[model samples]
Target: MLTHPMPDPIAFQIGPLAVHWYGLMYMLAFILFLVVGRIRLKQAHIAAAGWRYADLEDMLFYGVLGVVLGGRLGEVLFYHPMYYAHNPLEIFAVWKGGMSFHGGFLGVLLALFLWSKKAKRNVLDVYDLIAPLVPLGYACGRIGNFINAELWGRVADPSLPWAMIWPNVDQLPRHPSPIYQALVDGVLAFILLWIYARKARPRLAVGAMYVLMYGCARFFTEYFREPDWVVNVLGWDISAGQVLSIPMILFGIGALYFSYKFDKKAAPTNVAKPKQKHAQ
Candidate 1:
């Protein structure tokens, strides 16, 4: 079994100010959004929809707010509400570390809804446009988690090749779950979404696909990672991540059904039909 490198959290210091890898990772996530968003804007369907760089920039602005606020609140309310409630001031202590993906997901949806209203665009359209751009950025955040060695995985079989031992945790070989998530939830999701989004489908289809992909991916990965908290649902025990994902999975299925059942406008195609007629 291999041992975790346990890299220092701080990336560098500029005079009096110190920068953390975690913060840099967040910055990278935003940058990836812009970079990938630009490429997404070039798609025929997206461009025909009149999305411009200006709109993309504005969406990024709103998305950052959603991610920060939603992630923090999710962590507070979902994970440690009682502690935060007892020490309310600690709620503002974001630098101490606590954020939730599901919370950020909801926050971004709200932010995008507001942006959609301002841009006079359909919220589902906005969601579809943005869905393909998110997973790589998510991978970056998981890398940040790995660097901090904060969310180590459960114990693994000694025979597992890549099984890692987080020195800070214990000597037992453990699945390096962050890397697993980065690969599966982040990279894999991005690949599939990017390919799927390359073609037009019914309205809300892409967005629903993203929700389903993330929910399933998160559920699968949770098995490797240690549970943050467990909830007893009926008689079965489930992790908080799984608990959160259950709704997303259901919503995805429902939305996909709705998209295919009612929204018959979009049919899968690689390119938009040419406006000009050619001589036959």
Candidate 2:
């Protein structure tokens, strides 16, 4: 029997310039990434691989671009293409809020690829380095979503403990799906991935594990969260999030299989061995 906090989306106003909690949450997410990345840089095994703090800053720059652009575009193209087609200029009005995690994920991949090339490092290696650090930041983003009262969950049984009523939506109790996602997809995933990524096993395994875990989490959570859109496939009312996650699940499985089966170096260890140091 909990009520949604429905806090003001705007954090503060500064003479015609307003600061928002959503923006602050994103800032926090980036800050967390840098902080965790710094810790990763200091890890004995990771440090031996020639990871530097400056490199992380450079990657962060690329990541910001990727998240903003990719998330906006994904929202437009995947969720509401027709709407955006009519209101084309609204696509750039990111401050009004619309972003897709899948899009941001793809954006990060592209950003990582570009960073890997410029840093002359193996792309998979870079992915492995950053994968574990992502979940906590994701949790923050979900918190932002909750604060904005956007992406509210589907209807829920009133009898259920912790069932919440989002005043913006309706009087019916609904699952606090954002919190669920933050816990399962963000915190829990972080714990699992952090442990998995601790000692390197294979080239693509860590990154693949991230994809697999997130895909599974999102798929499971979609049942509770309200679908932004749905498509009927073979008479199945599948969610857009679920549809996007299917390919990720497949790719994760494929990448993991490839990592272990093809890469002779694949092995469990307490201390990760350094790969060939690429020119920076």
Candidate 3:
């Protein structure tokens, strides 16, 4: 059994302003988005599609707004609507900490939609381009969660290797679920999605793959983590996260079917063909 390090949340301070590791993690996530987006743009198909650094920058700006606003609102509304209703002013105190990935996901979709409209690009195309870049950023957020020691996992067997005890919670050994999520949901998902997106598939396939991968990953990880809330679905108990993921899974499957079945024109192309040298 291991004990959580419980590092200080504040990384450093400038004058009266104390900077939190969570904030730094977010900054790192954004930086990674730009860095990875640049690499993604270098792919022949992406370059041929007219994506530029300007568009990536613009999208990041809008995405930031969506993530902050949507994640906060989701935390308040989904988890503690009544509490927030009673203490409305506290909602603005995001520094105190609260966020939701599902809400952020929705927010990003809306932000990307607006960007697509402005850029005169199909929404699915935008989604495909951005999907592969998200998981690593998500992994960063989970690391932030671990650093803050907010979302501790459920109790685990004492014999389990790497089982951790969050002194703040209890003495019982628990799964280090945030790390599990960072590695599985964030890192592993990114790997799979990045590989799949390397070559073009049907128009919506790449985005759908992300939805499916994340939905499955989140559903799996939720089992290890403590439940935020439980919902009774047709006499079966399930976590709120699992409930939310179900729809994403269904959407992914449905969209994948539609992409391959109906949208045949959107199939993979040889747009990424390598340039050949002329006979010497």
Top candidate, metric lDDT: 1
- After best superposition, candidate 1 residue 125: deviation in angstroms? 0.7
lDDT of 1 by residue, 25-122 (tens): 88999999999999988999888888999988999999999999999999999988999999999987665456789999999999999999998999
Please, what's the RMSD in Å of model 2? 7.1
- Model 1, position 176: C-alpha lDDT score: 96
lDDT of each: 0.91, 0.90, 0.90
lDDT of 2 by residue, 1-280 (tens): 8999888888999999999888898999999999999987877778888988998899999999999999988998889999999999999877656789999999999998999999999998899889988999899989988998888899999999999999999999999999999999999999999888777568888999999999999999999999988989899988988999999999999999999987867754478788998899
Off by over 4 Å in 2: 267-280
Per residue, candidate 3 scores C-alpha lDDT tens digits across 1-280 of: 8999999988999999999999888889999999999999998888988999988899999999998899889988877899999999999877556778988999999999999999899999999899999999999988999998878898999999999999889999999999999999999999999998987678889999999999999999999998889998799888978988999999999999899887865745566988999998
Model 3 scores a TM of: 0.92
Give the Å shift of residue 88 in candidate 1: 4.0
- Evaluated against the true structure, the overall lDDT of model 1 is 0.91
